[model samples]
Target: MPSANGDSTRNHLAVNPVFTAEPAHIPRNTLPGDGLAPDVAYQVVHDELMLDGNARLNLATFVTTWMEPTAEKLMAECFDKNMIDKDEYPRTATLEHRCTRMLGDLWHAPPADDVTGCSTTGSSEACMLAGLALKRRWQHARRAAGLPADRPNLVMGINVQVCWEKFANYFDVEPRLVPMQGERFHLDAEQAAAHCDENTIGVVAVLGSTFDGSYEPVADICAALDRLEAERGWNVPVHVDGASGAMVAPFCDPGLVWDFRLPRVASINTSGHKYGLVYPGVGWVVWRDAAALPEDLVFRVNYLGGDMPTFALNFSRPGAQVVAQYYTFLRLGFEGFRRVQQTCRDVATSLAERIGELGPFRLLTKGDELPVFVFALRDDVTGYSVFDVSAHLRESGWLVPAYTFPAHRTDLAVLRVVVRNGMTHDLADLFLDDLRLAVERLSRQAKPLRGAESASFAHGASAHHA
Candidate 1:
């Protein structure tokens, strides 16, 4: 009994098939050697997400990438979940309502009449909605004024995000760009006014330029538009694309009058994922009043028996992100948000100051201007290029974007760092330390690292000239 039982147990424990029954030719570990295993990629991604508590503050382009456990848990709950329960989540409408109210108050919407807004997947969709609304309103105004409908255009700075171009392309409207020069990085009031005529639908003044993080002097733009309106009798309105700066500006620069306080600004659109401190796939568009939102744009859908009013380009979005945004508003009240933004500003300023001492690098925009800081190689750094330094930084796992200035400033390449949530002082220090190391390494390199000329490889440019 012992012999048979032991033999069978030993046989079962063998790592390979029994030689007694099968031919022995292959090794047990023989398998294809793909470069990356799925499990390994998953682990690396998990590590990256958890780095700095995922509060690395690396995303200055937006508020921050959401990595809070609460956000993750909420997202998991919403995956593959339906959002059409009229009975259970009847108060679900309150989610959008609450966000609308918060943004309305922050943006300083008028005290009287009904203010209208909606949540979108991101600022891109919000911009699309804003453009569509402006177009519809322009058409109505044109019909009322008995003007020729042949031409309708939007005036904006060349530094505007690509979405503006897409908006014009999608609606068949002319995109009248106010080109940027060396001294002027935003849409000049003079240039913007020149583009406006009876055919102009709206002038989009960016509160925060995506390229430089500069505010486009909304007050000046509005005042200039007012003068044009009085002189030309043109009723063109202003739309503020505050995707990156909307939330942070209120707390950091409360005196800034880029919001609804400006008489000409008809609607304000922002990315909830950016400064709102929510995860991606959440954006908001707020019209001054119900009258601003076109009736034809809002579609009444009868789902789960009751009719629900929907206006977004894409329907059937997950409710989890919305719930998460509402949670952020509740969790981080006004004071909390201000404190967080202030922390980012302070850390970014510190990094800027530290980097200022480094040789051959010039600060393009002051860190205090916004959380984003842009830098370029100084003239004294003859042999070394910003592009070369960016390649060095990449070796150390930094994702700082470097690129050339748009249009007129294409000859100059710059680097930019976006300070987002989870970017603590310590993390900033680490980044600076790594940057120093990268700089030293690049200095010791034998050759210059020039970026590829093609747009496909443009990611390399974001590092040195972002």
Candidate 2:
């Protein structure tokens, strides 16, 4: 028997009707007694997420915010596949290998049938893996020569991403960070040479500094290490943290020699999710040669029904991101990637030009290298600070981050904007308008901004431009 309001053929039954009407009140902290309808649960979560900052308008992060519809479809389809299980999902492994080869070739790896590398959860894991390889290789050489393999140390600038610090802490390597000063915000060859010793594992040269969108002098650092090796008999390799620039320099500035083109660059790591034009959570680490990555680091496991050599920090991650990366590589070949990166560089340059014209700000980096830039308030402009302008921009849904420099350069506070793939000239123009308005609003504030003094520590305190 069906009611007059109900369809005669449909069964009108409810397992838990209590939550069906008032889904908004669903307790988020604890598990419910009974599950609600799928749509109801989805709506509750989705509605709450609507309040989050819009991804497209976020200028502080270097992560990709958009992708093609086809890439989205492909990622959705392979979301359930686990990347670690090479036996069950062999094709995913194949795709990963192909991607590695492509990256190796792109980075100018010597002509070889296979390259040693792996996909990571992000640039952080990729960096960790690269650090491990460098450490192991150094240890192997030390042990062969009957030298002390203990007290391994890594060298980099204070401008390095925090992941490098994490790598040092987690892996028992000493972090010798070079302090940044005035105009020199990156690790120079002299600074790196000063940090080297017999116990030094490797020198980390940042291809794209997260500080001010500048590319560290990789070749110069390598040459400095070469001289150090000749003088002190301590041979140290170079690992390029190409998180953002690896993808850009290859296309935008082909003349840049920050990659394997330099002989001493043993390994390189890049975020596939950043400038690689893919969504979040994908990174790569490619060694110049198979010998650069020690055999002991790769774990050979047959638990997945095949002999698979795994060399990653995490296991059982989503293979969909890797697939999306492959899709991006295939869809956007060399020419396509070049055009996209060139356009982003152009937009960033244009924005930098326009923002520099604002008169209150002094351009730190001109966004000519990696589609990113940083600027500081002129000393003459005393009424308002970058923090105030940052706060005002938030009202317009723009997430421009303002923070002080690290270590020796902490006195200089600046604002940074990371222009990604989807950011266009029109969006840049709109952002400029909003930025101008924010500056205007900040100028009119009667008192100092709420928590203005502490605001410098809020956003990019630990994180640099990238």
Which regions in candidate 1 have their CA more than 4 angstroms from the true location?
1-63, 83-88, 112-114, 302-307, 445-447, 452-466
TM-score of 1: 0.84
Alpha carbon RMSD to native, model 1: 9.4
Per TM-score, the best of the predicted structures is 2
Q: Write the per-residue lDDT of candidate 1 for residues 277-308, one digit (tens) a residue.
A: 88877899999877778898888866457776
For all candidates in order, the CA lDDT equals 0.75, 0.87
Kindly report which residue pairs in candidate 2 clash with one another: 210-465
TM-score of each: 0.84, 0.92
Please report, as a residue range, the 10-residue window in candidate 1 with the lowest summed lDDT. Answer: 454-463
